[model samples]
Target: MIQTVNGKIDAKDLGITMCHEHFIIDLSKVRGEDDSTLQDTKLMLKEVEKLKALGCQAVVEVTANDMGRDVIKLREISKAAGLHIIASTGFYLAPYHPKWLQESTIEDLKALFKKEITEGIEGTGIKAGIIGEVATSKNKILQTEEKVLRAAARASKELDCAVSTHCDMGTMGNEQVELMLSEGAHPDKLILGHIDLVSDILYHKGILEKGVNLAFDTIGKTKYLTDEKRADHLFALLDAGYEDHLLLSQDVSRKSYLCSYGGKGYTAVLGYFIDLLKERGISKPQLDKMLIHNPARILDRAC
Candidate 1:
């Protein structure tokens, strides 16, 4: 097995591990916070220290192929910061694409992602260690999205990398999973991000049955749903026996949408998620299982 300093995990392990969270994401022209790219290595180290203080041993920085996924920079900064930083390879949201989106194909996208995981990322000197935060191109999980996800799903299976996605707001995960499964990607290697918006236990349960990992990634963004509602749903999901297929995180990256009014923006997103679990009557031991044990299993598998 591909073991780490820790042991194993599914999605949840109360000694909780955050599966997808961004310390900083470089959206090129779309600016938020200060410039936290490679130039701000000290700041990055400081931030990782905070996560460590909170007991986060690792963080998967699933920045996309077209976005600010600087693998060389990520390795240097994460190493200095003493965090097990795992980077990913895949496409991003449509808006973030360059002018070449008009001509890209499944093979083209796959070749680029393969190069990153194999050769290197943009010749930056550090290679991508994982697969995604892969988002589909379709408005819903349709043909275009399916094409990208199919390539990504297949690539992940071949490379033994985990695949995650930036899902549409209204529970588009069902369609997303359809593509991954169709492409022979084991659902265990796929994480459906943004499922908190699904709002139906039966809907999520059905999706979980397909065996893809579930990501409760938007934990601290309480404006859309109350903290109570988010916690209740999450706790209920844990109780629903899908624990092995879950991933916990605060998708606390700056995208103008989440930055209108905030402190350091991503700061305290982890803390907020942790506190909500406490308020919901979830004990510390259980929290560790969801956050810690399960995530380890998901990442270290098939090594």
Candidate 2:
């Protein structure tokens, strides 16, 4: 079963999921920017409704605990938008980690993550479905960040949940995979995010060689990379027979990325990019693997 904000459900029911996203979060603690906060439920629901129209039934909200995770708010948003929202449980990068986290042992961190997954987050009865967006720095995983990643991996192994991660500027994918695997995370259950920002097919191939999934998330965030370039790189992977190992999402966390705030909204990948892929001669089966089957493979937990 895949745990969602509403409760455990069959993994096959998590239809057309965006593997990485954020909603009802405040990143001001780490970003030092007020615009990073996505607090308006009314506005968020309008954007989510657009995604639903494009057949987005679920979204994995990967906002970590240190990044202003609000389970109650997530539940409210999922119910209001009629989307199956998966909450996450883990620390992010070192900077986002709480001062107390710096002192906690790996076992301490593991227990907390397990509690959130098996019990409930903060006594709210809202369990986290996934074990990440656990992250590292640009070039290396900090000692603190490594501890959290290991703990998250251990927790995921115990709970049979998937693990997602934030790859800064698309760096350290290989190292992240090594660490998670060393800590007993199955490669198929691991997803490395923001890979589209790298633009290096070899860098992506290196990570894929480790048997992990790659999230071409951050779609429509043209300031970092264009969707055309993203599509080009994605086609290379599909051509190389890695379609089953790919996932898609927008990772829209800011007000500027939301349609209600004059941005593209959550429908960019399903609404716009899929059409771009078809124009590029991507067949229907390949598109289905990327959009539906790939996410299902990575996110479907054995119940």
Candidate 3:
């Protein structure tokens, strides 16, 4: 079964899933930019409806607790949009880590993640469906970030939940994978996000060769890399027969990326990039594995 903001559902029902996204988040505190906040529920609803129209049935909301994760708002959006929204439980990069986190041990962080995943998030009775967006810094994993990653891995292993992670600028993915697996998290259950931005096929293959999953998630953010190049790298992976280890998403975190704000928004993957992949010779079955089968397999839990 796959846990969603609404409740558990059969994995087969999670069709055309976007593996990383954010809704009703407030990153202004950490980002220090007003545009970093996405608080307008009505605007978010409109964008989500566009995604629904594009055939995206679900989204793995990877907004971490310190990144202003509002599960109550996520529940409202899930109900209003009628999209299966899987909320996350974990801390983000070092800058977003809260003050209390510095004092917390790895075991303390693990217990917190387990409680949020199994019981409820902050007593709201809306449990998180995954443990993620837990992150590492660019080219390096900070000490505090290491603690969060270790704890996330432990919680994921114990609860049998997938742990999606942030690989800043797509760097340090190998390190992230090695650390998480060393902590006993299953490689298949670990999704390293933002990998598409790196533009390194060998780096991607290196992570996949380790038996972990890779989220080619930053699909439409052209400032980092073009969709054309993203497709090329993805095609290379598929050609190498790693389709089952990949996932796709736009990682649409900022309001500037939202259609309501004149950007590609949540529909970037299903609405545009899928066609790009097809044009680059990514077959229908390979697309299905990345979009439908792979996400369902990773997100499914014993519950």
List candidate 2 stretches off by more than 4 Å. none
Return the TM-score for each candidate structure: 0.82, 0.97, 0.98
Q: Which stretches of candidate 1 lie over 4 Å from their true place?
A: 1-16, 28-39, 137-139, 142-144, 255-272, 283-285, 301-303
Residue 269 CA error for candidate 2 (Å)?
0.2
lDDT per residue, candidate 2, 1-303, as tens digits? 778999877867777889899987888977899889988788888888899999998899998888889989889989988899999999888887889987899999999998998899999999898888899999988989999989988887887788999999989999999998999988888999998899899999989999999999999999988899999999999989898899999999888888877889888899899999999999988887777777776767764
Clashing pairs in model 3, backbone N/Cα/C closer than 3 A: none
RMSD of 1: 4.3
Evaluate residue 284 in candidate 1 and report its C-alpha lDDT on the 0 to 100 scale: 67
lDDT of 3 by residue, 181-249 (tens): 999999999999998899889989999999999998998899989989988898889889999999999
Q: Lowest lDDT 10-mer window, candidate 3?
A: 275-284
lDDT of 1: 0.66
Q: Tell me the spans in candidate 3 whose CA falls farther than 4 Å from its real position.
A: none
Clash-forming residue pairs, model 2: 1-303
lDDT (tens digit, per residue) of candidate 1 on 61-118? 7777766766666676666766666677777666656667546787777777777766
Provide the global lDDT of candidate 2 against the true structure. 0.88
